[model samples]
Target: MQSAGNGSEDEAQHYREGQEPPNPIAGITGDVPGTAVQAGAIYGGVHFHSHANDEGAVCQLPLAPAGFTDREGELGRLAQVHAEVGDTRQVRLVVLTGPGGVGKTALATRFLREAMAEFPDGQLYADLAGFAPEEAVEPDETLDAFLRALGVAPGEIPRGLAARSALFRQRTKGRRIAVLLDNALSAAQVRALLPGEGAHLVVVTSRLRLTGLVAHRPRFLDIGPLDAAAAVRLLNGLVAGHRATIGAGTFRDLARLGGNLPLALCAIAGRLVMRPDRSAERMVAELDDERRRLAVLSRHEERPVRAVFDVSYLSLPEEAARLYRLLGLHPGPDFDVRAAAALAGIDYLDAEEHLEYLVAASLLGERGDGRFAFHDLLRIHARERARDDEPAREREAALERLFDYYLRTAVAADLTLNPGRWHLNPMFEDARESPAVFEGRTSALDWLATELPTLRALVLLARDSGRNQAAWQLCEALWMLFSLRKHYGAWTATHQAGLAAAEDLDDPAAQARMLVALAGAHMNLGEVDTATELYRRAHELWVRAGHRLGQAAALENLGVADIVNQDPRSAIARFTAALRIFEEQGEARGVAIMDRRLGEAHRDAGEYDAAIGYLTRAVDYLTTTGDDYMASRALVGLAACYLQAGPLEVADTTLGQALRVSQRAGARMEVARVHQMLGELAQLRGHPRSSREHLQRALSSYTELGAPEAETVRQHLADLESDTGEEHPGEELS
Candidate 1:
């Protein structure tokens, strides 16, 4: 008999699709539920009840709602819980917890009232007032109430809380009674009210999960946001006689706008019922404004929309409340543990615990990915609370910290995935406790994919917030985006926002950087002339700023645009001009990059000897600098030049080195390019089968990367099959 806590629900809100799911309590016992669970049939079971009468059962439970329709699942779970009572010596504990207005007390009333025959000794109910605006009902006072209901005369009831509880237990001993502790605050309060060693049942409904009850090994049912279909059914049932007066579309809008919160649904239905002349459309229209939706989602005479939220919010610990408020400030759909840590300015573990506590309080939802989010209405409510309660500077600081954390972490991921991109010097300090850590390039790319939308939104936000330097740097940080990822649209949009921010700051260097990045996006999109104009602007800005490296990089980009235009002569001229400055700067990486550019321009112009000379220099320089990933690319180009010169042996050796280096560096794109070169070389050397295999692997790699070259690789495989008289057209590369 370990004892004590307040209520239960939604520590883990969602689960994996099609997975039967682990014990939902996995996190409380070291299992986490950051990833939310979908709302559906939960903890399946059969419900059975006897039709026998309970002539003398003192049922003080509130009347089940007249409009009550679905809860068949919860009712069945209740019956299952009741059936398990005989298997144990102590009273069976069934605790129901979820968000306020989620209809906990009503569900208990519906279950206990129908299952009266299972508890012949008696059925008792008490509103413990745990989440009441005022102090909750005490355990002692509750025992007094139970004693009197158990036929104890007022004079015979004990004065002491412990004694009265003992008397109540003794009177109900070995009796198959059912006790409903509604609106309970803590397990300790209910612990004193549990029947001792009997086949009796004790059901608890609370706003917080009574985690303290874990010691007693109670069944915890986490009631999620009410199901949408079920909520519609509920609204339809509530206004049954008035259905013709309600619009079907209005009910849908109402259910969605309510976030399927049963309490809100009930309130909406109640409004329709109260105003028989009103249409569901009219009422839903009233509830449509997010800012005032909560206020309007109320019962005719009940406390307004935020009343339940107020009571629940006030009931939480101060730290938990602060976390809840600050978390709402994050402008993302959902956020991971690290972001939560930054939002609260707390340790990651501490932030997680705070999130758990808020979940327990039914304020936040945990998704399966270890991320925490809330229903939109709750989010809006939290934001309103933060604005009303917190100081302006505090809120702004928290937002800036969150912005800084995401920018710094995302930049780190970008560098990990695309190290060859030019890095911008951050003008602001990183506020994150720890930057994001990736296991390898694959994981870094995955993180970037997941955060893409959030980062774009933040760039726009940064620009709007007057954080011009941060906004532009954030855009420039993804400089390798056009080459590595297939996010051309996002590439253009983010840089556009950054360009505007750069103009806002009146910073010429920032403008130059933004222009070059935008030009890269256009160059990738095949708008060579547009790209040239942007790069020209960037080169001019760099010239005006006297930034030699910037000027060289801009010229190099212009050369890349010219290459895409199939004007290798222009590309060679630009690369040559850029090379003069690159060599003067004497950075091996920069010089190697220029060498690769010059080699590629020469290769495209069909000058194999010149390609070999420049490509081999790039290979040697990049290899000495430990830039094996880019070196692999240089080596592949050098191999292609060797292939063009009819030196199969040298080409084969170089291609093998490129393969190993790229594989070791986890540069799949470069590896794919190497395979493409190998396939062509093998085809020329009369290795038809070998050519097919290399082409197939290259196609698979290109397909996985969403690169357009997959189609070319496919055509190559088809051509190899055709010439060899081997038919595997769709079979090999499709």
Candidate 2:
């Protein structure tokens, strides 16, 4: 859709003396000097809203624990703390500190649920996993998730902790939000997430008191074991049907044996509920004996929770028990049915059944998203059981299956998104099983985004476990996602590990791919020098390996680096070389892509005619191939050439087409680029108000994406304002 032109009759009269227009096209036929150029009347009707109103209430809190008991006094204390701090502009901070299995998380979850009405905007929750065997969740990772929940697109999210932290604060600044930071390791992690100048409530749970947060004046609530009466009530609720059979006195005995801890009490109750035929007296004796045995073995005071875990785990069916042990080796924070099936080497239905059984036993928690996770103490116990019961070979085999599953599934998703892209990984054939099927591009990208963190962990796990091939292959499979989402942190970390793994395996092709991928991240982040070095290294490797496609890809990357370095001549040369290889290989898509890049290089060098020829050919080929995303990009470049040359009307039309196509393809970044060029075109036509409108749209989109170009656009807007003085009536441009 095009907007109407504001050219007055006088302006049209001035154009009447114009010399012949630069290009020959359908709309223009000019001869006499200063004659009116008969470009068709500016078509106007389409209004595009690139950014939809998707930022609404984001409720990320998981379901509260069932049968929550006691803590009336603690709840009152929380209310009192909120009363003292909630009215302030600063974020209200509360720390629930206690030992593991002492119900700290349960307490926080319960309090937040009850206090939800005060935070109408929504709640955010994250498990820091401070005490888990794996690395603690980093603040940047949590911030990324939080920002996405708050409606920040993945590509729009900034890289690095500071930028992301600042963006998070900006997004949540005035929202009355509630945040629960579970199992936090340190005050630093908590501090990075504090919202800016809001009446937000932030609740943190940790085993340590987190005295480091004392400066924030956090209201520290130290949770302990539930009172005896409360523990009895919890047991009574969980094992209601069996309470009569267990008798009233036995409930107290069981609660005492469980140390009145919620986790232990739940486990004890799970055993009672599962075996309605068994008497509560017999269950208490079994738990007490296990506690004594563990105490002796540990050479410490009695471990009631571990004892309870042991009893519950021992009661599992053989298949369920095996699945539980194998799950301990899972590298991710949580897992779905498919992952569980892979880990246990069982079919999906069987794995689902086993997982449900584990949940019923209180050894696992349902995430309510077709996934499951274990409590910190329960996870530790499961790992211990796997170590003690399963053989080393069996454990390794289960892990291998998991790695294969992820690699194959990720490769499937990648191919779905970019089927024609060259790939070096053999996992597409070597890894067995049907990879996860995605319905389309949107679903494929969604899956990739959802599993990114787990996939990153798996890459490290594969590398550390000596599965070098799988490690590098996983990185290769993730290339599509990194390119689309621009998750720079994961992109850098995984590629580094993948590069190391390739080196260890002495695979030159794999190493080259990893280097090129890593370089792309640096290039996007504006580290052109670093990117150039990496691309050079990769090119050398590709040449040595005699991989023509790899060589071409590397050369193309070098061309991009050259452009970023402001060496258009060198970029042109590099693109020419890459184009030659693409033609030799008969790769039509690659050829078109190189042509697009060449057009950009020429445009930067002010060779507008050559740029237009290259860009038009690219646009034609890409459009014919139904590659709307690349076609939209080429159209933008073509319009930029038109804007620089003559025929501003043609530039406007081309931009309208580009905007429509980019929106159709969901290419937000390209859409922003088109808007930016449109803004410039409007300014050239003396439509100052229209220029500001387009420029503002560009700035907003660029800022959301955390692109460095945002600053340039902001400067452009500042200059426009300076030039125009104040807003005035002007024709709008589409």
Candidate 3:
């Protein structure tokens, strides 16, 4: 380790030498700089083609990309490939990938123009029309053109794919050349075009990853949105000789708001350059109003990013467009085709076709791994269009369908996870049918958690739609995931909305449920007094409605608030009261939960042995109830007692078990407590460095869950840093 660290420092010192000349290939010392025939070399040995044969149909490059806009990075990669094209022995295939209108073609053309000198024999360029108005160019057509370029008679090219590939490879085996396979359909199309055992470089630009070309080991380049600097540079380049009047900050704002997409930026710049009178600030303001920008900017027939999207949208079958809009409602950053289908209320195969159509129009992007995402700004754009174009009634209908989908699915998950638990009221409406039962609870929760944001939106939408029961039922169905995952922000907002709706509808049961959720959020935020008030009101409402279960939950929550307020005596009394009501109602899960709270209050009130006794019972009750997540919480509380009661080794062992249990059940909040206790133990043992690591991990978990304890732990970490004169590496534990 010492030697490795020293070597790393030595390398850093060497790099800091300002006088040293640049060396691109210095790492591979003792070899000739340019002697090796690199991967893309096209050796010249034979060309058996008829010079006079130019029949059959041939396609040229697609209109030179209409002054191809952005793609400096693609251009740079092509430049690198061109630099070593003369010496490369294997085929160097460069894949240019992105959402449409990101200028893949423009970059390819620019590369061909600049790198033409490297390939003396010729540059073979073809437009395969992956997203064309007509049928995609056939492989035979591409091969025939290539064979003709190799001086072979068009008739000599065979019709079979294998035969044509062989002839094409043989013809170009010995020649130094470059092939630009533009808008390819798949890896198969381009793989068939590769010259066998030769030096020719092939650049295959496609919208998809085309994973079939494993042998080529292609250098995959995902063309992400440009950074602010690159976007500005491209804008300046587009409006050549016309200086930008906007300040640097304003220009950057426009670029960011445009999502740094080359096509969008170029269009904005072109407008600015042409108008000359409109200030950049005015355009920025228009872009900031995301709801109307697409409609307003899409007035022009040409240069329509929005129009390109509309064309794709309008062409979609009614079902497909409906699915596309629902997809816009996805809460996660990206999702697969299956989720898209689920959102659209369709089959997987049908969804795949729609995804392909969207990709064709550059409305969505496919990652190398085949997952899809809309550009951040573009996604906001899609959502706006979706909301605007679809009628409000139709939109609400779709949202209801989605909301019920998640609610029903979550109920099924709850049953699968704990088959004996009391069932919440399923929506049971014809419009609220679940798509299908999942394979297991884990799979179900994964989907629900992934779709939580979208689900939350649906809950709010349902409440606004006056579907009061649907709104509250959705919240109850997802309570386990929401509380465990610590999605407090969404949880708090949804319940608040639900509470208002229930009050408007005069549903006491719904109101009680919403109040419990509201109190939990306040408790999680450290608003103890506010939480206590909400919990008390919820308890009263539940009693008025004669809801024993809701009353039990409210009492338990009040106990937690009292514990936070440092009134252990009050906490214990409240917890015991809740426990008796839960037991009387035969609520095993509720009794187990209250036992943990009661144990914690006892521990705080200096009853260590009694605390352990109650906690031990709590663990046993949770096991009996089969509530593994809550069971882990009891274990964590027990571990904390052991730590405070002076059995250091026992506490360490128990905390380890708690951590494992929490991790196995994906209880992030419980896991955070384990870290915090372990950290406190480490500090007691005088291992400040290790203590910091544990504390930092604890802080991250708490922060992620929006736990009330996060700030307390953060301050503790700060104190440690100040005392030890060592800055906290916050993410070191992870």
Candidate 4:
């Protein structure tokens, strides 16, 4: 049988006021008429009573606050745990741990008192006094108190701590007693107190994790600071008549000022109710300063807030203090051990130990998933400490390291995001090249998408650091991901930063690239004027650099924008210019792309023969360059032109060629477009069933691709379904 430390609630000064004259403990008789009894049991006093009256009569173990509202979820969890008893499924040990003044004791007491029926033998409660400034009660003393509760003779109690605990456990071995051990010193202190065997359920509450005791197969419940809603509910309930007098705003302000801590909220509510006339608003205004927390709390004649925090903080070791300060420097919402270790310049194992210390001190939180975070108020408190304690240069160094790490990682992610985009100079040159990582194009792209926000933050950080080259390079690396994902807002912002950085560096090539990225966003948004302006500026920059490839890219983009704006003539002129630049540069890829655009402009202008000629040239260039995907698109354009010119045989042959190339290239969008064309051809030939099938396939492909043409394909499919009296196979067009 396991033994417990000899700590008793009777020794704690934080207990309710006044020592009561010895009263009968069993079957509480009518409030003793002005006897002014204490809230919980008074140890070693003349309060003992026998259950000889009948079958185990009701015995009040502790006075838990009634209607302990708003922690309904926690209460339910307690009930669920209590229900786990009696099935030999292992006696459940739940640890409710948190910082001082977070109401761990109160919550445990309430849960145990309400669940007393489930543990009929009796309920044992003790305060380990782990955080008390004075001497803590010994395990032997606490075991003696438990023996006295079990009707053990004073002289008969064993002198040995282990023997006394074993006898105490043996007494309640068969009978289930719910033990609530509060203010636990450490895991070792707690291990001695746990009862042997799986018959008794023990719930230990402490500020520290007590992970050592966790190995005994106890489920841990890490209690954090209460949220605003629960804190306010707890506070309002403590006031006289339990009428919730605090206004919503005042309650919110009080909850926040109390740091959403249950004990603090309780104290504030008690003070407010006692005063009656003083407004919570004025109280909140007074408690704004961290330095004045104690003073402000003392104004209500309740315990000081700073004192409570100090009791928790002063219990920690030196390592925990340093880690707390380092944690205060983190700007992210949560952190992991690796980052914490990096900040402390320590090994991961040492950092984890220090982290547990801070968690014990209530300065840090270990979430259910094992990630760490600080309470918002504690975060603020730590940051304040960091500002006062840590050197500015040191902090800046840490931040820079963090920023650089993210920048390097994000740049690595970019290589996979777009395997096809050929950037002139490598981005993030200072980042160590690790070609062994990223594995494949898909892996890189997935990483980039997942880390996009962090990458964006790093870009901004680089810009803020006056690292203009890094800023521009960061933007460039992310170009393909941003473009393909259609994150136009981020695309625009990053490119704007890149544009300024490029101009600062006086790099015309970088300037052209930035404008091209910006213009892509504008083009996607259908802002032709903005797109044209950016494209023209990019073209000018490229021309100044005499970069034919850059000039061709800009011209092609400009032509596409013009075509989207319905300025077909201007688009044709721009496409022809781009084609000339590409041909001169021997860039077959660029030439093919420009030829396709030129054909589209000519077709839109009703010049079918000219469109066919340009498309044929585009297809030939794409084919020679082995760019079957682009070749397929050019062939589709060729087929459309021939179909418009009434050459059905030529159209059929061109369509077949496009279909084969598109299928081979695995270009789903192009494949869908080919199906759409065939569907239209089938409709013209009066083959309703075939037309419906092709159109439906095209719509399905577009939907899968999330392509803009999905809606149009669905519309065509609906029309074919309607013509064939086939129940409109597609959903309503609108």
Candidate 5:
């Protein structure tokens, strides 16, 4: 310590005397310690030294992928992780895992390039070739490269793996660097290259799970295949210079055929680019065949989607591979373990284990809530595997079991949601094996909402495959979802398919049911005239089939159409006749629903007293029955009556109650309607700010639902703004 002080004091004296001090290290030259050093120096001796700090920050990040599209979500997640790991002692490690050709490396590179400012110490990149045909790069090689990038002299670098790792940590201490270890083979490979200390960020992209990085507290992000829109964009970018013209629909078809994988889409785009004279429509027709689709997507043999998928598929354990192949036969968009078990003819525990294994291997993805789904391309590859490897009988049996599972599960959900509703499908009586259980109407509706897409697809599949009964029944089972959730597109499409299936079967009652469902969809879509025609046809069919309940249901739907058409007198007559039929049939719920309809009609007719009486009775009955959704509608009607009459306070209280009931029941339409009424009431009370707030909330809800009422709420907000002379008003009053 004394000798160190004496040397430093002597150097200080030499500096004060206006003379340079001797270099402390031999064969070294620099201005002074704690001062900037000049760039570019050469040293030659047994012992050589250079100013390590003279090197500029290493900017080793590769150019971001060309035509990078729709990774804002992943980039945002990276930003969030960076924000959360602020200034921590431990280095932040983010592992991006997904199947090959899923664009994990592109996402990582894009994020790091955009985030360069965060790492002043600079960027480093290494490609380990984890899933390539060649052997993966070793960790020691990556470490060596990283050490050199960090400005370590060649002679000073350690030879042993442990020493290199320790030196890397020592070199990176207190430096904020960003290291991208691309195509990593394992957690160990990634670990060896990670910065040993400092608030650094290390992002690793790998096709494998790399679960061994758990001790490092790595955040794992799973990159999935591009969506259809992004896939089309990628194709468009790749083929921008080509003379070939493709229609939007043809592009979408190509994207679907390619399973929206970026690699496959690029190949498709390459085909279009190379053959500029070829028609995309013809290309789509050729790619539509599953057997040839993979071949078409293999235009780029270097990174063919099929070959990439084969590598992942071949690496899977035997049981997981078998389950993955059978999952290709699953008719639904996604599946749970129970459905997988049904497809594979295995038990739940085994299915879960296999599915987990596939998920880890990136052959499958967990779709939340204990469900798993394959990437579309992986699904196609799995289908090809099943077609080639599995016997025809086995494939057919797997599909049949999956279809049965979906059918029985849909029926169970239907009966649970609509207890005692008339169902003509014989599948209701068929024994269900391991059907999904719903605790109540809410749970049933939730399940229906989540599975709506799958259900719609299966309905079409069944209809096309000559499973007529299954088709119509699946449509009928979806009635509750369509009625409540108001997915008008799915409702209309599935019912049209169901109607065709019904006609094919020549069943009058089934036809009536499908017509009613289709009419409801049209009614919600503002096609009142079309809805009315459908309802009348349904009523005629119900009469022909001698089904009075169906007849009453049709009458009620027609009354709803009448209300929408603003013909209160016609609505009243329709509701009155339907009410009588419901009463005669002892359908209490039907009667309450009719009462609500009558109340709505009376409110529009300027008969506040009659509306109040009808709506109050309906609300009391529906509330007692735990039908909060219907009760909220009736309450809104009652509130409108009170608002039209003289009791503003009662109207406000009623709307508040309706809002709570609608929210609790998840009746989004009713919730929006209540907000609309509240906005009108606030307007009437000269509370412009309050009116604007309520109307804006209503507008947001309606806009999200794609409901026409959004326009009404927007008009309300506009009028309030005009009346108050406030272009943008202040916060709401108490």
Candidate 6:
């Protein structure tokens, strides 16, 4: 007998580490019950896959997945297989093979439910777990389970594989029974669990073909993707009347998009039908984004899409399998041999070979343009494997190489569009071979546009994966796209992610730099307070680090925030302080940028002379530095001062120069600003026709830029129409 021990730290530590003292009453089995005594073997690996029947004498087959479909014909065929045994002593065997999540187990379970009438003795079931993420079950372990189910005593069950197989056959001989072995990895596993001679039926399901099962001449069903009609029927059944309002064509589209797979359809259905308020259209709309399709399909934690695909993924060859996961680290949905090579850090031929192996395993799908993709479920599964199976350091290294690939490629592509900007390059310690190179500017732009979605996603990926440097650097490299193309949403999203990564790194310098970038994104988006807070944070970090240059930049960002808030006095103070730092550092470019900002502040405050003087000097400074983009911006400030100071000819000439320079430099937002200034200059001159034209042009450009400045342009256009006796373009002004 053992006495209770007080729960001290020492005793708790042992329990926490799972080394607690053994229970003293584990073997005390003298309690009496009001039922017949039944003793059964419960040896290693011997247990039920499901609950026993009400009588507790037999294990009941588990019900199939809800709304089972497309198996009516197969069930009838399976019944015939059992009938044709016709007095033969050999046990009837059937094998079902299909791709993962194509409902192989579901089909088997449904068949068993229907065939329970034929097996008078009992029905036994086991999930062989061949495709489990950890490892497949061994044949001997399965035999141990069968022995206990047959009422063999724990001590009497044989230890050797052959002896266990012999014992399993002997126990089931001449008995009418049903055995379902699901997710079998090989023929050996199936053969070991079969009875020697009996009116017994054994059914096996696996992803692999398991051709060795052919030696037994068992009945075979090769399941494939459900037909369109059957898939729709299955979806309709699962959605219950929630989809009744949706058209048959739309339902077909949903099923087709699900790749005519039962699991995919069911997963989406599970989400919609369960939520009474969520519409089928809304779910369809959510699945519209291919990048998010898998996430949408896996609506719940318990029924994750990755869980089904992990089994298939874990069953793959090591190289092919690892490549399958590494392929998920790819930035885009599909990839060619070169992209695969880049991802796996292998050569093209080797990548192709590995990819082909994945295709053979049904882990990858080949597409047009010599590219391949995972089923959306498989992609999610593969990524999950990359996170769970691969070590953190391993995934980090692979993603680093991928980042390097994306960075270098983006730089190379940028060079095609703006050759003068080629000098702007990311520093890789040892650059990998190019995944691809650009042929021309159009191709480069197309590739950039094509990769935009993933590039934005990778920014967050780098942040979440603890690669802080890569996160900020990738966003920095995307400055050209944000500045020129003005995908405001992507700009802010990536920068926000970069800021998070930088903060997590706890490096003041990196955090300050990210703060500046993110603040600029917020400024562009017209989020004045948010931008101000971000800049203030940067300023504090820079001050703490004593980085005068970074502090100056942060100060200037804050000045921009003040201007947005209509506080020109505060803006001037910030700009003056920033300009003093720039002057101390002898940074002419910084001085020019801050001086231009000061000029805008003065102009906003109605101080025309000060604005003109500051604007002219800044433009001269920027022009000498060959920064035409900044020069254009300064010239616009000068133009604005000229327009306000009763100098029509000079304002018109300065505006033309600003327009020409900004357009040439591809400074889209600046060009829009110049157009708005030109429109105002025209409006001052009473050229209503020209003013309307210029204002409309400015609005169009602002709209295309996705800049919040579009609202300002819209208001200006409204004023132009109201003053010129012209009705608003589309609607009555509020």
Which candidate tops TM-score? 1
lDDT of 5 by residue, 71-189 (tens): 77888999988886577587998999888887888888898898899889888898887763245675566777887777776665544444455557767778888999988766666
Instruction: Mark the 10 consecutive residues where model 2 has the least summed lDDT.
Output: 15-24
lDDT of 1 by residue, 1-734 (tens): 11111111221111101111122221222222221111122232322212223347676767777877687888888888888888536778989998887788888888887888878778888888888435677566788788778776665554444445556776777778889998777666766677767898888998888876776678888777668788888888887886465566777888999888877877777777777876667667777787678778754637455887888888777888898888778877888889888977889899888889998888888888887788877887888788888889989989888887887777777666555545556422232234546666767667777777778888888888888877898887665444566577778898999999988887888888899889877765567789999999999998987888899999899898878878899999988888888789875578888899999999989998888899989998888877766787788778878888868889888888988988766667788988888888766766677778888889998888666778889987877767845543333211
How well does candidate 2 score on lDDT at residue 186? Answer: 65
lDDT of each: 0.75, 0.78, 0.70, 0.69, 0.79, 0.73
TM-score of each: 0.77, 0.60, 0.73, 0.67, 0.71, 0.55
Model 6 Cα displacement at 333 (Å)?
Answer: 4.3
- Sort the predicted structures by lDDT, highest score first: 5, 2, 1, 6, 3, 4
RMSD of each: 11.0, 30.3, 14.2, 10.3, 12.0, 17.8
Give the higher-lDDT candidate: 2 or 4.
Answer: 2
Across 1-734, the per-residue lDDT of candidate 2 in tens digits comes to 21112213332222112212121112322232221212233222322112222766777887788798878999999888767655647788999876567788888888888888888877999998665313468677898898788777676665555446656776777768899999776677777777766888899997655667788888987676788899899989998866465567889988877768776777777767766777778877775663242332233224456664665677678999999999988877888999999988899999999988776545677776788886645666788899889999999999989998888889988877666677887655543345458877778778888899899999998889898999899999998787666778889999999999999999899999999999988887788899999999999999999999999999999988888888999999999999999999999999999999999999999999899999999999998887877888899989989998979989999999999988766577788899899899888887888888898998998777667788999999999878935544647666
Angstrom error of the Cα, residue 580, model 2: value is 1.1
Worst-scoring 10-residue span by lDDT in model 5: 33-42
Candidate 1 whole-model C-alpha lDDT, 0 to 1: 0.75
Give me the runs in candidate 6 sitting further than 4 Å from their true place.
Answer: 1-234, 237-263, 266-323, 331-339, 347-375, 384-396, 407-450, 621-624, 722-734
Residues 652-711, model 6: lDDT tens digits:
889888988887666778888887887787666666667777778889988987778788
Local error of candidate 3 at 63, Å?
A: 11
